[model samples]
Target: MRIIVYGTLRRKQGNSHWMTNGQWLGDHLIDGYELFSLGHYPGVVEGTGQVYCEVYRIDASTLGELDALRSKGGEYKRQLLQTPYGSAWLYVYQRSVAGRQRIESGDWLKRDAVSE
Candidate 1:
């Protein structure tokens, strides 16, 4: 299945830190989606912006592993969203602050770009 990943996973060499690592297929621009900081991790939501994302083509067998890494029913939830790339599932923060704006398309905030 094709999955769209945003947040920390999108950062250079960041997603590799996880044991259940996914292959980086390529980068994509998700229209009507926005990026927001959810706790220490990053997530995306439905909005009017172009959210930069990393696309991953993974086997269905890895779903369990991915779910575990994402803390199933915890910090994040697996959601199905329709993006320009295609229909896919993503992990997003369950709780979010109201009125938060997401990153524009092709405008990913790299680790070095984030102010401490």
Candidate 2:
């Protein structure tokens, strides 16, 4: 399965190890979504903005591991969205974002640029 990752799962990030067996299909910008700083990591939810993401082709076993990491039924919900790599799974934030800092820049890596 293909997946779009925008936060810790991105290249060189803390949690990217989870994608060790996946292939990087390049980066892409996805619209109609908003990124928020969920502390050390980030979360994306469907909204009015866009987000920078890395597309990957992962196997079923990898998908299962990712689902568990994202807390598939709790903190996030996996949904299929269009990407340059074709339809891919995106982890949409499911909890209230109230009081959280919005990564206005959309790109999680460049999130610091927003306030700089």
RMSD of each: 4.0, 1.3
lDDT score, candidate 1: 0.63
Tell me the whole-model lDDT of each prediction, alpha carbons only.
0.63, 0.92
Could you say which candidate leads in lDDT? 2
| Clashes per model (N, Cα, C within 3 A) | 2, 0
Itemize residue pairs with steric clashes in candidate 1: 35-102, 50-105
Model 2 — TM-score against the truth?
A: 0.94
Q: Which stretches of candidate 1 lie over 4 Å from their true place?
A: 17-21, 82-86, 99-108, 111-116
Local accuracy of candidate 1 as per-residue lDDT tens digits, 1-116: 76777765554546544424556677777676666754466666666777677777667767667778886658677887665556777776666647644443335455236444
Write one digit per residue (lDDT tens) for candidate 2, span 1-116. 89999999888898999889999998999999999999998989889999999999999999999988897569999999988789999999999999999999899999788374
Stretches off by above 4 angstroms in model 2 are 114-116
